[model samples]
Target chain A: MPKSEFSRRKFLGFAGTASGLVVIAGCNKDEVVSPGTLDGVDLGSGDIGILNYAYALEQLEAAFYTQVIMTQFSGISSPEATLLTDIRDHEVAHREFFKTALGDKAIQDLEVDFSSIDFSSRDSVLATAKAFEDLGVSAYNGAGRLIETADYLVLAGKIVSVEARHAALIRDLISPGSFADDTVINSDGLDGSRKPSEVLMIAQPYIKTVINGANLPTY
Target chain B: MNLSNIIDEIEKADGEAFDRVNSRRSVLRNFAGVTGKAALAALPVAFGSLFKKAYAGTRGVQDVFDVLNYALTLEYLEAEFYVQSLLAPGLLSGQLAMSIQTISKHETAHVNFLKAAITAAGGTPVDKPGFDFSGGKGSGDGPFKNAFSDLGLFLAVAQAFEDTGVRAYKGRAAELLGGEAVTTAALQIHSVEARHAAHIRYMRQQLGSGVGNLQPWITGNMSGIDSELVQPSYNGEENTMQASVEITGINGFEISAESASEAFDEPLTPEQVLAIVDGFIV
Candidate 1:
């Protein structure tokens, strides 16, 4: 079967057995069930849930960039290669930072399905990068209100700006002066924001792991 | 001032002050006895009213009004710089002109939005201060005298302003935390400023004339521009410690200091931001 179809089947299987796995885990009080043992990973609740949500997205971005550098799009210029490599390193650092911060609460490594992306083609690679960076910015923006801890909010603030920076550069790479174009930035000059549920739905196709964001705080 | 006298002063400034204060106090009183999801649900309303009280000139409180006014001042500086740059003859052509025009519109939009928000919150918007883009402090001839005439110098100054704007907003985000609507709006605008900063950095990279090896993201507190005038904007940006965790070489990822710093943008205190911006403000 094709990779996309296979991932879809896997996701459906996880969804079907999600409830059963939760009940099983509940009965085993002393057993420390690993994240991998569950059919779907629950992002936990409150701040941990939000951090895991961020970690999951970072994992997808880091994985994508690693692949981009390894394959290298056809006819990539030296300048482009250098910048893309920098972006990959930044994403890797971000992913690791969240993982380390979350410690035991961090979700297992998410399996990404990038079958839809043509990594060898510049257009395909850049457009996907743009989407991920934009989505990342919006996710942080929306999640900021949900963060109760001031330090966590500030941390989210620190990272969201970098994601915005990445989004702008990727947009410019596609079109010279379209960095803050109207599509992402509204007429009021505000960048877009997306709730976790909305963002997760959009990101579902790219991620093979079934992410349960039901416990995330929403306002 | 005494308590009653202060209350009278606030009432004179805002007629609805007492009503808002009472309602907010009642909410808090009710919330005090309650717990769980219900209290959480009413947080935004309580926070909103609390912010409104702060706007009514509540002493000793750094309210949302102060933050918005601070932002408005910065927006005015940016909006006017772009407006004047576009009007300058023999400067800004082709893609560079287009990018500046796009950024200019956003700055203007931000100015308008902030003014409206302040007004809606029962606070008078601060007047737009006169800006001498040449960094003259009203002298009309400072380090960036050719800011409008020379494209390179213009971009360097623009990059400084955009980077400062991003840092300034990031610094104040925590102040608006409980007020969800304002917090979300500020975050939205904060990201837009970052986008503008990145685009300006990209332009500098493309120019590559007097500008140093500039990347879209800041690297190691190094002001991509060689001049010391713009160095303040990049100060403290070299920080690799986040939430008390030293990011460099953490988790054995071989993450370089530059990459670690680049992954997270540092916040500049309001005083720090004002000091940098005061140079251009007449």
Candidate 2:
């Protein structure tokens, strides 16, 4: 259950008012921050902030899978279809969990633009899915420390591994055994995690609302 | 801020910390002064059925160095497993072989990363342990006579390693809070292992050996998995509740209790994981 009254607009307004906490950048258009109100979605500081950040990604994933299922990839194989559908359900469940957990403090439903994706083509669809899933995993890993609550961190761990599973499945479908390729994973066997700011930069094109994670804890 | 272990213990008990501070928190207080940051970084998840069961009484790593080394040892085991599999003359070919090759790289990368990190942090990296995949020690052949001869056994072993790895990292993930970067990096590695596990399951399903409908997770049926060397990896994976909340039948959507448990993977303590890993090591 949500702990407090944390409306999206209210949090954004509060972020602007709360000591210039968030630096909102990377919008589709060159929008300037208003005198007191934030121009885009401002993830609040601390645990709530991290939860909102994750919610945004889950929403994007759920939304993408919804479309993928709506128009199954042209001649999609049975196994692929089944796995994709399973992933969709998982994403929906993850999205709902964050929404309920954050309650009023949760951010508004993020507007996503999948216009660039060629849903009809399996290659196009799986590639974008790969990108989204990979981004989601790294974002969770990157943002783990910003979380103040241990339970929340565990919840994050729970969701992220699934995303990784999704990523690996998508990658294999595209190219068998390419799940943990050299691109995302570095040479050190250590998975490279980006900071929230770095991840949002890559995720911004698909997301309508800009996210301000400048105030998030980075220990 | 890298607070010492003493401060972490003292600070976790809030009131006691205050009392100690009033008394002689000077040593810890001075240590804090030296570090200039909070004694702890990412706090460990303290709730969940498994947390209450698996995490509460178990021992945590002494410091980030020990954490890195523990991880390093596992990576070594995994990396060597893949390397040996690839080296076998008649085990795999084509796509299956290609996949093994790619995974081998990732595991090797992890081993290299942890080794370098431990060395960079002024701690000695744990040396790679010699492995006997056949569950036999010093005999050059183990229980898995077909480790290189049979693909099914190979995948089973891979599943064991990857699944154990996923839970193992999760068990210690939060405890490595002293070094957030390492914990985060470990989390990243953890998911990749999950992906490998899923892929292996997928491969098994494709082979049509009665596990055709296998999902990416453990569904509580341990029928085909008879290897004792890998059985303990499934320890506590049957948990149905998360953070004390039942995962099934929420919001009128009837999700299977099995799927609910599968949705979120549980963690295995280092001791539990090592018990399984040690069986394969000479």
lDDT of 1 by residue, A1-219 (tens): 443344334333333333322312122257454454434788888999999999999999999999999999999999999999999988998899999899999999999878877788888788788888988898898878788777888899999999999999999999988788987787678887777765676676777887777677875
Interface RMSD of each: 5.9, 5.6
Per-candidate clash tally:
0, 7
RMSD per prediction, one decimal? Answer: 8.3, 11.3
In lDDT terms, how accurate is model 2?
0.66
For candidate 2, the chain B TM-score comes to: 0.75
| Residue-level lDDT tens digits of model 1 in B105-196 | 99998898776665555555667767777787788988999999988888888999999999999888777766555677788889999999
Instruction: Look at candidate 1 and give me any clashing residue pairs.
Output: none
Instruction: Score chain A of model 1 by TM-score against the reference chain A.
Output: 0.83
Model 2 Cα displacement at B22 (Å)? 44
lDDT of 2 by residue, A3-107 (tens): 112222222233223323335433224555435445568777778887888888888888999899899978998878878877876777677777777789998
Top candidate on DockQ is 1
